[model samples]
Target: MTTQQAETDDSDGAHEERPAAIETIRSRRSGHNFDAEAELDDETLEELIRDAALAPSSYNLQPWEFVSVQDDNALDEIVELAYGQEHIAEAGTAILVVGHSEPETADEVFQQWADAGRMDEAAAEETKATAVGMYDDDRMGRDYGIRNPSLAAQNLLLSAHARGLTATPMIGFDHDGLAEFLDLPEDKIPVMLVAVGPSGGEEPERLPRRDVDEILHRESY
Candidate 1:
């Protein structure tokens, strides 16, 4: 096994020897049921999201936004959009990951750089222009819009896992219905739904993975 893969295995009874980060990741499982009485307040949810926002994005633009679904009415709507998945409303919170494909993010980022003395106003303006030009292109904008949000979603899942919370990243939902439910702007795109809460029972059996040799290519396929 590779060093990372070896570190991920705890079957040898060296659980305490593994790094905390790896242990958190290896132990995390997608929870199907949550303790309804267990609650995650807005402050705690925001704290988790703060760490998730630190996830890397192209140009450090941080193109994602999260909507914490806590209200019963909103949760019901999301459950409908998600094809009546009971877990949608059962989790303490369902964070919607949305990505922006507009020049507005570039404007905000460049302006911040200028304010922080990281770049001169002129340089910031030039950089914004270049970035806006690239993001204005249909394919590139769509690619970044989807990919950046996905990165944030993964970060959120890991962050929640680290915080002793169970989370599931779900993509099986009606995208257009969710967009309408969230009242997203034209430039915003819904990318993922993350259900998070305190652990409920019924952890599924861990599935076997392909051998490293089968997946790792020497140089190229």
Candidate 2:
């Protein structure tokens, strides 16, 4: 991951900037059109993925997987699955964010912590036991499966924006169709579709936002 350094402009009219992290989050918009000819390199994509994977998860279970579809032929099929969303076809890459509910992954997660000296063998064993016990319940497992991936998807969007790439989260697709199209494993669930690329032109007009006064509540409702 690249560390974003603050840069100062020499012009007299320059203003102090927000931290890069804050600026990136504030600047993100739902981009609908993309320059199809512009291609994203694998290294940049990997960096974005790494950054996204750092999102918090329950017990560090990290159940999500990101699949990038960049081929024209593959994208054509995705367009169909996405109900013919033109952006899917025009965007340089379509990222499938997938997650699964398997408790087996917990073992690996705990083992990694043990190997890294973050936890001793006894602690790792205890954590594994607790994680497996909780996730063995069908309802709890299903909740973690969906909830953790959604958090990771947000991280991916923010990371893409921070990297100077435009991305849009799409939830309008046929989920089963996308699963089959992507040949996703039966254990996995499709969380969201993100289309990333350079903008086709100027971004669309900014939409309105609700003021904090509309959402904030003092103490309690």
Candidate 3:
């Protein structure tokens, strides 16, 4: 990803700098209008997914998976599945953020932690056992599955924005149809779909946000 230079205001003879990460978050807009001709190459998409995978997860299980749809035929099918949201086709690439409903990676993750000296062998094994036990309940496993992947989805949007690309997160698709199309295993659940590409026309104004006082709660809601 390219680094964005901080903006300076010479008119006031003052220098005000903001972190690129903050700037990317503040400037990101959900855009559906995209340049159909503009293409997102494989390398760039892979980088974005890598950044997204850095999002934190419960027990660090990192149960998220991504399905990238870039082929013309696949995009067309996605548009249909999404109830004819043409932007899925226009963007030229759509990422399906999926979550695994089982802590299948716990063994490998804890083993690595022990090997890296982050945890003693006993402690790592104990922690892994606890995590596995908690997720053994079907409801808890499903909740964590969806929750963690949603975090990755947000990171993906920010990653795309940081790279000077436009992205729109959508959840309007038919879940069963998407699952069938992707041929996902029963343990995997579709969480969100994000369309990523360059803007085609003038971007709409940023919508108003709720005031901090209205949304923020102190110790309790």
Candidate 4:
């Protein structure tokens, strides 16, 4: 096993040894059933979304877009698309995670980071201009959406877990049907569904990780 993998295994055991960050990691688990009595307040959901949006992307392309299905009609609609997952309908929030490669509002992507003070006007404008340059570049344009969007989804899931809520990242739905149901234009591809709500059970089990030896390499694959 590689050092990182060893550390991960040790960390699993180390949760009992360490109490701060490890504890948070240990404490956060995917919630299956949730408390229907409590719903996600708007502010908290926005905060969770803000944290999730901090996820990194290639060239700052930031291709993730979410459709928050909070209304009963939408929830019912998503349940059918999600292959009839019961928790998906019951969860307080369901984010239809989409990978949008060519957004009509690319400026908004950089504008967000700048609005958060992560970049100044000069830097944001520079970045935004540079972003436009690569719009037609196949390597950066098309694939950036796929690569960055998946990472952002992970960020959203982890952030949701950190906020004392449970989340399930599901791709077991009908993608084409979902796209049709959402009435998305060509720019949007429904990649996954994230269901979030209060935990109604014990900490869920972690899926076993492949050893680092298998996943990592020093120079070449």
Candidate with top TM-score is 3
Clashing pairs in 4: none
Error of 4 at 217 (Å): 2.2
- List the candidate 1 regions with Cα displacement exceeding 4 Å: 1-16, 114-123
lDDT agreement of model 2 with the native? 0.84
Model 4 CA lDDT for position 130:
76
| Best of the two (3, 4) by lDDT | 3
Predicted structure with the largest lDDT when compared to the true one: 3
Clash counts for the predictions, in order: 0, 0, 0, 0
Candidate 4 per-residue lDDT over residues 1-221, each given as its tens digit: 11122133464554234544455554566677787667888887887778767888765566778878788778888888887888876786898778766745667767887899999988988987777777678666666666777787877777777677878889889889888887877767787788988776665567887878889989877
Q: Which is the winner by TM-score between candidate 2 and candidate 4? A: 2
What are the per-residue Cα lDDT tens digits for candidate 2 across 1-221?
33344543333745555577766776688788688889888998898789889999988888899999999999999988898898987887999998877775887899999999999999999989988888778888878888898898899899888777888999899999999988898888898999988777778777777777898999997
Clashing pairs in 3: none
Lowest lDDT 10-residue stretch of candidate 1: 1-10
Candidate 1, residues 1-221: lDDT per residue as tens digits? Answer: 11232244535755345556776777777778687778887778988899889899887789889988888888888888988888877886898999888756787788998999999999989988888888768889988888988988888888888887878988889999898888888889888999998777677876886777899998688
Pairs that collide in candidate 1 are none
What clash count does candidate 3 reach?
Answer: 0
